[model samples]
Target: MVDTKLKFGVHIRRAADKAAKMTTALSRLMANTRGPRASRRRVLMSVVHSILLYGVEVWADSLSIAYHRKRLAAVQRRCALRVACAYRTVSHEAVMVVAGAIPIHLLAKERKEVYQKKGQPGTRATKKEESREETLGRWQEEWDAAQKGQWTKRLIPRLGPWLGRSQGEVDFFLTQLLTGHGAFRAYLHKMGRARSPMCLHCGDAQDDACHTFFVCERWAGWRRAVEDELGRLQPETLVLKMIESDRNWKRVATFARAVLSEKRMELASQGPASHEGTSSSEED
Candidate 1:
């Protein structure tokens, strides 16, 4: 898969194609409605991702070209969307964060670095662990500085703690809460799918992730149920509380599922409308 100019562009495309085929083959298991998200994530990493990065150490340098990187990223993006059970409209950066999948370019660089450190290692395990730490450090820096997905960044400031969690599951309702990219009137209005950003339930504030999760009175009962168990909740401390225990995680996710399901059903009942005046400020 070499080109006339000796570039590995053809090889990269072939790898992406092969990986995409693998994703399609496992579509049933990765379907957003059915299988376990954690299992889908594992299959993505162990199979599809493995195919995409099969010889990344050699062409890792080629990832400096944005086109090559995007080609591979597109393949990963498809699987990530499934893993997070997120809407197709979510940005690549945001979806990757919610899905707990590393960026393709960074992962390629990590593989290259690990390969370079092959012979000078104390143990293969030790070197690999060190490489992962370095990669996660770089990823955290990027996450902090990123302009998109500001809402998600507020909730998950650090990738390490979120990825380290052994319990919580990612499903459609939870993904919406995590990414701020679904069902919420603010996001739908921004995407030109809704007439207004004002909350149908609250009517006093914009229906963004923050307003719906913490401020909206419509979910007060469910919210109170969670707060009764875990103290008063805020965006900053929500993730901390969620990861504190399996029961806590399930409670938070249950709140998300209950609230978002109701929101989705209500929005569906409203039907479509013409766009109205735009808001000057963005939602958090």
Candidate 2:
């Protein structure tokens, strides 16, 4: 078992090493771009690097876990070293800085135009045949589209940077925003869809995302304690404020996802019952 694990480690290391070599190539392509010629290759490389780093950061902990047992520790260590080396070449911070600093919309436009022009006969239909510029442009579109309907856009700034994440990560966050975070609660309330935006768990008057996750009664005593700790280091954006205010944000987000997951969970469980209860009390 140990020998097999060791061999697997060797294989993984070689693969990571190859990725690092490719990352260097990306760096060179980025550097090689010059004036007015529209450096599509450079832009593509940046997007690729960001995605690579995002995956590495997310799995870094799990990857380390494999090292916990003696049978796999050596392989884990080797893989870790290879990952560390690759990241050193193209750090997550660097990728974030580049992503944040650039005008993503404009870059996306450039990429689209480049791809449209490159569509010619005798060319391979595979997406790989498309220029690097087009690929990143598509990614930008996806990120923007993901942000469109839901409310996370208003909340993420306060939430702080989601370090080492790709545009794909936005989908999970978006799911939280629309369903679990209850950002949609207000919309539902406005449409007379929900019984109340107030916390059923805590009976707090203001039951937005913060109240539901941090100040609500539903979480038992633990949520409030976590909220107090977060309040001390409140984030800048409202959405992120809720996220950062809790040490259990990830856990809570998962719960929120579960709660919001069912189309009628809130409606069937809390909505009609609370609405009727309120009406009966009013009549009395």
Per lDDT, the best of the predicted structures is 1
Residue 40's lDDT within candidate 2 is 35
- Regions of candidate 1 where Cα sits further than 4 Å from its true position: 1-7, 62-67, 273-284
Candidate 2's C-alpha runs over 4 A off are 1-108, 112-151, 158-174, 178-185, 220-252, 258-267, 271-284
Q: Which lDDT tens digits does candidate 1 get at residues 1-284?
A: 44532556777788889988888777667656567765446666567778888777877764343557778888888788888887766777777888889888888888988899988939888988898999888888888888888888889988989989987878878888888877788887887778888898669557988999999888888899899999998999999899989999889998998887778778877876423222323333
Residue 92 local lDDT, model 2: 25
lDDT at residue 269 of model 1 (Cα atoms): 79
In order, what is each prediction's RMSD in angstroms?
4.1, 19.5
Error of 1 at 271 (Å): 1.8
Instruction: State every prediction's TM-score relative to the real structure.
Output: 0.89, 0.33
Error at 138, model 1, angstroms:
1.2
Reference-based lDDT, each prediction: 0.79, 0.36
Clashing pairs in 2: 155-239, 158-236, 158-237, 159-240, 180-256, 201-217, 201-218, 202-217
Model 2 TM: 0.33
